[model samples]
Target chain A: MIEVKNLSKTFTSHVKEPGLKGSIKSLFSRELVTKDALKPVNLNIEQGEIVGLIGANGAGKTTLIKILAGIVHPTAGEAKILGYTPWERANEYRRQMALIMGQKNQVWWDLPALDSFILLKEIYQIPDAQYKYNIEFLAEILMVKDQLKTQVRKLSLGERMKIELMAALLHNPKVIFLDEPTIGLDISAQKAVRGFLRQYQKEFKPMTILTSHYMEDIKELCPRIVIIKSGEFVYDGSLSDVQKMMGDEKVLSVTTQNGVFKVSVPRQDLAKKTHELFEEHYVLDLNIQDPSIEDVIESIMKNGIGAT
Target chain B: MKWWKDVMGMELRKILAYRSDFWITFLGQTFIQLMVARALWQAIFETQGVSEMQGFTLEMMGLYYLIAPIGMKILNGPNFGFLAQEIYDGTFTRYLLYPLSVFQYKTLTYLTYSLFYSLQMIILLGIYRLFISEVAFTSVDVGHLFLGLLLFIIGAIAYCMMGMMIEMIALWADNIWSLAVMLRFFTSFFGGALIPITFLPVWAQNILVWTPFPYLLSLPIRTIMGLSTFQEVTQGALILMLWTLIFMEGVKLVWKKGQFKYTGVGI
Candidate 1:
């Protein structure tokens, strides 16, 4: 179990003006500004639960993950993961947790991924049988067994990400933090990664927190999600609860000779809107459906929970 | 211990990956330094119309030039910007998550490169002794040679610690390349890699002896050449050890403070 109370982080940066003249002037007198990356927030996650964190850019999703992963220190409050404080970074705590960042690689670029795996095995002190089993299993499931011997830098991005996932999961961690794990992959690669993660989570049941821009990943894997905006959590509940918050609104999408068009209407007006769309144009197809999770969440992001 | 061995093996593989680049840079730098020193010293000797200056004969000066570059290479080890560069690029976030000390891992990598450089120095010395037999320093005392090798290893470790101390400043500064370049320039100039300390004035030499610079390269070379007594060698070891401890403490303190300041951005 992981528990956080009033966890917050603030960052201080220098405010510098542009040009060489400002650079020389600021050397003598500088201005510093503080930005709150994470406001005081409370959260609790149970074992075997995967929580999807949704936010726009600079919305503090990464900061929250970094704090829990022990990569960044918190400015206030406390957190305990499996009875250990993360920032203390005890070996016992670190050994049972894994952090995988898509934009950063833990494996050495110049050497083959297998060499890095062997080094990690030593670092984590994994038993021989367990290490061998994990190597074969993760490689086979991720479908990069052949690429393991190639230098990591030479492999394609998708292949490299699979190898990185293998490296992070070599020890079978109990808590996993994934930050944009499928950020830059193609559709097929993304599906493969999502399939691998879903299967792994089913077998291991590790408490997982995933942050991604892909709504498909969230919809497929996460039953529960927490929405953050401006360094604060605005909503935390099951996906269905968020959808229900739309409150009697339905979507009417019509495909005509021109193109497909979608509009949101109240439940009472769904029939009239569908009839009006069919009469207005040569409708190839028309349907009344629930608002998509993406549209609903996008609305919530642009306009706060009060608007919902 | 097994972890260290495995990581060191990885470090060795990285160093060997670009074999041609490594050799060209290492051998090319050594050759250029030796040629420049020889040209300058020959001109000075010819202009003075003497076989000796500052208690060093022309042959002895040539030997000094030959051994100084190799000795300095061993002490300086490989480049020292790994930490700073990683920090700047936010690649250092992995080290924070790993179940290992960043300092220990970096030290192992640094020592691995130093060991490779030591091997090169040994091969070069062997070739010098076999091909050029008329040099006065050829018949070196075995005991002094062993002591010098020990001092070289300690000095290399100390230099690694010092480099890390400078790199830890990356938490606050945007670019630490200039600091690293300045360190290299000072090490080479004051550590007697460019000119022998014996050529310097007495007061300057005395002042440098108290600093860690001379002990890093000049003292070890002097000890290996059988110019320093056993007592002086022991004193140099003690001073180097003390400096190493000081640098180690500084690194620890800076790392502790820097962790809070590290944002791990850009990833």
Candidate 2:
């Protein structure tokens, strides 16, 4: 449903040195530095696949998504979504896709969400029957039925996010780009959003590309994960493969007679066996076994010191 | 039809939802315009007799100021703030994702606000005309007034389009406030809010005559004041139509070309 090829975006910024005199000198004779937001990134998203784009701040995940969403013009390469050149922004192309940024609210602030949806319905030219059905479906799933008539500003954050989601999906777009769509929400709301997205994707079979800071969202919702760092694609495949890329550093956080004892081991099986009953301390206490993603990521960042 | 109806409906919904604000702003803006007209009348009466200024009689002057709010409703509605906002916040992408063009969106939104506010202006004008003795209603001028209104709507829509075109400069320009201030100042100055454009210097008046700014408010007022002939009204309408087309192209080109350089920052 979406194809991006050799896509790259570079931004030029004026380089100025420190101090007032240096700044004054640089103001007249400034140097230009080209910062690559995305470098030769290529990807193909088939219909109905939930792909998670993962990276830290300034990691180019959002940049790549914006390029695909037709918001940012790429400096080089090409992209196609739903039989249309995204950058062209044809009406037919627009009718087939939606982009939802979590930190951003799309609802008209002074008006009810329902009113905004109605305007969108007319703008998108959705059939009345289909519009009603989709609204009803999204309303029930997002649990925003009661709040639909309330002004967007009066609604809670979760309710507002649901409305934003409803507005994006109102036309049942064939492709969806979610940029940190679960950011700043409570855990329950986040899980609810993930569940709703999972169900929506299953039902609609849309091509979904989601970028998020929460690795759990990517781990649970996306089968395939793409990792980016400093404008380059580092890993592209399943979630565990990304974990394996950090090496077999099975982290075991043991809570025993001591408060906490964390071990960096090579194998999970051996760690679990040791934690079972085979090995015991003099005053054995609580035994905890978990190799969280944070430890793996920290290891990766530590290893990627000079690479950046 | 589909486009206009949707935009119209959006405007209607907005008025209904904020009916309190609708009434307050409507009255406040009308009163402000009325006072400005009254002050201008006092200044003219001090110099001249009970007769008209230029070709505008005292009664016609009252009527001209009375109905200028109708033009104001269409021309000076505050929708350009949203354009500046969308450009700054990067939510403009959602606009691009719509089947409607950005031009269509702005046009529809402007039309909506005009229709919604026109009703309020008409009601206020009706009340003043019925109750106030000084409020003019040369009664038999309905046909000309109606014709005048038809021309005014075109001028107002054209001016709003130009406003959007100017506001879109916020996407690239460092000083959006200056652009907005310039637009407001020019629209009122050339469109004849301070004085009837006929009274301005002939050279300045001739230049204003060629542009669409005067037609936004000045032409309709002149028509109401009986200072212009039917041929002049028709000519004014044609100039407005021409300017509307020009601003439409301006909007199209600015929006299309501007989106390319749009960084979509702050998302």
- What is the per-residue lDDT of model 1 for residues B1-267, given as tens digits with 9 covering 90 to 100? 799999789988988888888787557776667668777888999999998887777666766776787776666666757688889988888888888888898888888877787777666656656675357465466677777777888998999899999988999995799998888888888888888878788999989987899999888878777788888888988999999999999999998898898888886
- For model 1, residues A6-28, the per-residue Cα lDDT tens digits are 99999999888999988998999
lDDT value, residue B106 of candidate 2: 69
Expressed as tens digits, the lDDT of each residue in B1-267 for candidate 2 is 475676677667766677777666778777777877877787778787656667666666666676766666667665545576677767676677677777677677776676655566556667777876344666425666567667667776887778878878877762387677777778777887756677789999878767777888887766754556889898888888888889889988887777776877777
Using TM-score as the measure, the top candidate is: 1
Candidate 2 lDDT, A1-308, residue by residue in tens:
78888999997767788899888998579787989999998898899898988777897988887887777789999888877878777888888889898888777887888888888887888899999999999999998889988999998888888999999999999989999988899999999999999899889999999988888788789988787778887767776665555464455555655566666665656547555533665334444444566555544434542321
Name the runs in model 1 displaced over 4 angstroms: A19-25, A253-262, A271-288, B132-136, B139-142
Residue A123 miss distance in model 2 (angstroms): 2.5
In model 2, how large is the Cα lDDT of residue A106?
Answer: 74
Worst 10 residues of 2 chain B by lDDT: B133-142
TM-score of each: 0.94, 0.88
In candidate 1, the residue pairs with backbone N, CA or C atoms under 3 Å apart (3 or more residues apart, or in different chains) clash, namely: none
CA error at residue B92 for candidate 1, angstroms: 1.7
